[model samples]
Target: MENIKFIDQNLEKGLYLVSTPIGNLADITIRALNILKKSDIILCEDKRVSKKLLDYYDIKVQLFSYHKFNEKESVEKILEIFKKNKIVSLISDAGTPLISDPGKILINEIEKNNIKIISIPGPSAVTAAFSLAGYSDDYYFYGFLPKKLGERKKVYEQFSNLESSIIIFLPARDLVSIIKEMKEFLGDRQITIAKEITKIHENIIKGNLDNILDKIKTVVLKGEVTIVLSSEANKNKDQNIDINKEILDLSKKMKTADLAKYLAKKFKFSKKEIYQKILIFNKK
Candidate 1:
């Protein structure tokens, strides 16, 4: 396609940061193919995955492991090649390198060594998830979810009251438990689960956490999941909510505290936090 123009134009210079498909191999871009075809070498998270993709396109460019474990070690060898004025492309197992993947160290090394860098940006699971899930662009990406519970809480506290979407990558095995935890901790905040994207089983489920958890249990999900959650909607409730008016409105049919709790849940805040703020704000 016309997207290959930039690659041909700059084929002679720089460290090419190539992006590959997250799932479907057909998703690879022409410019990325051109860079890989002309590259001096490729650094990959896994040699086998890169080899398979390279084999599909019949690209004979050499590839070597440059993931987290051996990234530091590869830096010297990579810099040595850069000295020869040869361009290299860095790729990961899936998606773009250094985007919640490896090759970050190598990129840093290339820049530090003053090797010019050019990017062949393409398919990214993060952006794909957002597009397929209809997620708001105003968001924060955790890159990947924390496996540890304590770390999760500390992370949750940082974004608990913010007003933007939260996106996280999770493996299939941990999806259920993580979804359950979010529901229990964050209330009925809207969440979208995009699974097996671009594959035969590709699916997207958007709804409250509790309902989404039930749906997953019914189906045997077999791949990575992209989680997106809507942030607080009616932000600045105390300042903007018109406390007396809201209390009067909902109180006509529901208890004041209960209605406050319900409204708080809708915004992904805890009932205690909302009620306490309401108590103080009303007093003031």
Candidate 2:
């Protein structure tokens, strides 16, 4: 094999936030490869995971483990590396670092110290999944769902009325339960589940919420899943009318402030909207 020579070897002394391939190794950018090769030391969430990528390219460099568990403690040590004027690069196990991945503490410390922080953009699961989702380009990424059912429901309720598509990360094992909760709170909106994106086993499933639930109920999903939920604008008009009627009935019995707060959570209306409606109803 011919020796691979990277261009732009004169990398500045700073912390580099490098983006790795999310699933398919070949999906990585050439610039990202060049930076990784030029890095003096690479900080990764998992050394074992990063090793495979490093080994594949025959680029030997020091690998340091800097993860959520030890991020606080690792800050001083990382800053010490920067003080040495070494080229330090941070990469997550996959995708872009700090997108639902750890690196905030170190970045904050680096910023305070006035150390340069550079970004080497590449493959990101969030953008990759969304590109294939076929939903509205206007979307909001809601990282990972909460573990507790109540907490997860609160998240769903909070974003239930968002007019743009919602993208969320979920473990395959909990897909069924999460889908059920989404149906209960978000109604049967269109959904797209992108699994193992860019890999050989990559699968894209598109359907309404109810249909998606029924399809995946019997099957087992192996990798982490990215789900895209259609915006509230796609919901049935009759459903919104029913919720409005319910809010009006509650307004008759509950105080303006109390009804506004309660209905805001149960329905999609803003508290201010509900409050104004209650005031209007009381006048009649």
Candidate 3:
């Protein structure tokens, strides 16, 4: 490996938002490494997690614990470090800082005090998964879903009607239940699951919601997961039919099963979906 020289003069006295690798340590940028090497202090979610990366390149610096639990308390101390004209760098356990990570409070304070802040961009799981998912160019990142079932359901409902692709982070344990709930509220749209991104176990599973739910049930997943849901717009345009109105008018004469069969043949959607819609429409 070539020795990359660190130029201390290039970095200014300010708080640097450094983006670390999402999974593969080598995925980090040269500029990010340089910033970390030159920083006076490094603020991170977990010192143990950050230490591994720092140890890899032999970049020794003070690692301060700065996470959601202590964000408010850490802000004043960080500002104090700034007063001494020290170069501080804030990093998350993985990926970019403040993108579902801590740092917003400190950033707001830095701006209020007129302190300089710089961003050193690098690898991000959100963009990585989005790029590989092969969904629409436009997307809405919904970060992590709420732990509570009711709140999670509300979130699904909120984005159920959205036209663009949806990106969400999920823990390995909650993957099965969450996918089941998604099918219930979001319908059977296409989905892509990016697991353990950039690592040896990295896997991308793509299929319709119904098929994905079945596939996921057989396998056990670990590490971080990023899910990309294809746009409702794409499904709508592909079918190009007002399913509600069609079900209402057709049900006036035909039985539920017969109507479902008729619509299933005429459209791209599944018979099970049409049957459910017919039942729901008639009950209303």
Give the best candidate by lDDT. 3
What lDDT tens digits, residue by residue, belong to model 3 across residues 199-265?
8777888888778877776557766689999987768653545777788677988988888878865
lDDT of 3 at 101: 84
| Candidate 1 per-residue lDDT over residues 1-284, each given as its tens digit | 23334344546667888999888888988889988988888888888888888887778888877888887887898888888888788888888778888777777777777778888999888888877656555888887868799998777666566678888988878888877777655655778888877777777888777577777776676667888887766234463356446655555577658877776656555554556556655565
lDDT of 2 by residue, 168-263 (tens): 999998888888778766666788898888888787888887678767765667769988888877666786687668766776687778877787
Better of 1 and 3 by TM-score: 3
Ranking by lDDT: 3, 2, 1
lDDT of 1 at 115: 79
TM-scores, each model vs. reference: 0.83, 0.83, 0.86
- Which ten-residue region of model 3 has the weakest summed lDDT? 1-10
Scored against the true structure, residue 179 in model 3 reaches a CA lDDT of 80
- C-alpha positional error of residue 5 in candidate 2 after TM-score superposition, expressed in Å: 4.9
The TM-score between candidate 1 and the true structure equals 0.83
RMSD of each: 4.6, 4.7, 4.2
The C-alpha local distance difference test score for the whole of candidate 3 amounts to 0.84
The residue pairs that clash in candidate 3, if any, are none
Stretches off by above 4 angstroms in model 1 are: 1-10, 234-276, 279-283
